[model samples]
Target: MAIHELAVNAVKYGALSSPEGHVTVVWHVEDRDGAQCLRIEWTETGIPVIAHAPRRSGFGTELLTQTVPYQLRGTSTLTFKPGGLQCIIELPAKGVLQ
Candidate 1:
């Protein structure tokens, strides 16, 4: 769901907004304390800078801070770069099938 939201945003306002725009989504796993951790990244380029963070209160912000984490059992961080947005999500790998 978070991926979908990010994709939609990219299409509506981020990397996909212009001819030079682009978006990248990647993920990997790391071992920590004998447990696996899944890390996902979403990056956007070619978007204009509007705000340092998401709006104070909105559906997007709500999802970023609450819904996504609840559903994935993970935590997320957002960074706005000169080009666009970057998001990182980290999740525990326990009980998850490969």
Candidate 2:
């Protein structure tokens, strides 16, 4: 999936919603339980605040909860913290192309 959508969504409502907010994405290939896998950590900082999760799901939620995992055979978890949102994704490295 094109990350542009995700970035756009973030800019519109999530991490990038505020001028001071920032997003950091990091991914690496490593051995987990003896299996090669790609682990991604998405962290958001400087968010004004996080009251709670959205009552309704939207494109961002769908992409993170459904699209990325189902399409890429990955497992993902999204957490909403008072500080910011944190997303973690891990997938088989064999399925990835470099």
Candidate 3:
């Protein structure tokens, strides 16, 4: 659901809006602060330019910033770079991993 929202936004107003733009999604398990975590990085590149972050928070922003951290006890960050946007999400990987 989180990832889907990202893709939706990307297609509507992000790098995906541009003909030459691209989006990359990657994930891995790693240790953070002595705890194992599943880190997912969503990156957008090849955008012509990005003026700045959105002026207001949307449902996607609330989900990433509030819901994920509060409900899943994870962490997330949304960054607007010169060329595109980058979102990093880290979720606890305790019993979920085998």
Candidate 4:
């Protein structure tokens, strides 16, 4: 659902909106605070111009900022850079696979 929302936004208003824009997704297991965790990075680049963060919180924003922490006990950060939007999500591996 999270990725879906990002894709939808990209298609409607983000990097995917332009022919030259692109999105890269990468995931791996990494050690954080002495614990193993899954880290996912979503990056958008090649955009001619990047929009500023929305003034209001939408469903997708809420999902990333609120629901993810409550349900997954993880963290999500969205950064708006000159290139495009970047999202990083981290989920603790301890109970994730169970």
Q: Whose lDDT is greatest here?
A: 3
**Poorest stretch of ten by lDDT in candidate 4:** 46-55
Flag the better candidate by lDDT, 2 or 4.
4
Q: Write the per-residue lDDT of candidate 1 for residues 9-41, one digit (tens) a residue.
A: 788777887888888889999997898988889
Query: For candidate 2, what is the total of clashing residue pairs?
Result: 0
Candidate 2 per-residue lDDT, tens place, 1-98, comes to 42565577678777799988889999899888898998888888777667666688777778878987788888878888876878888889885846
How close is each model in CA RMSD to the real structure?
1.8, 1.8, 1.5, 1.6
Q: What's the residue-level lDDT of 51 in candidate 2?
A: 65
lDDT of 4 by residue, 1-98 (tens): 77898899888878899998999999999988899999889998866666576778889999999988999999999998776889998999898756
In angstroms, how far off is 20's CA in candidate 4?
0.9
- Assess every candidate by TM-score: 0.84, 0.83, 0.89, 0.87
Candidate 2 stretches with Cα past 4 Å from truth are none
| lDDT score at residue 11, model 2, on the 0-100 scale | 84
Q: Clashing residue pairs, candidate 2?
A: none
In candidate 3, how many Å is residue 5 off? Answer: 0.8
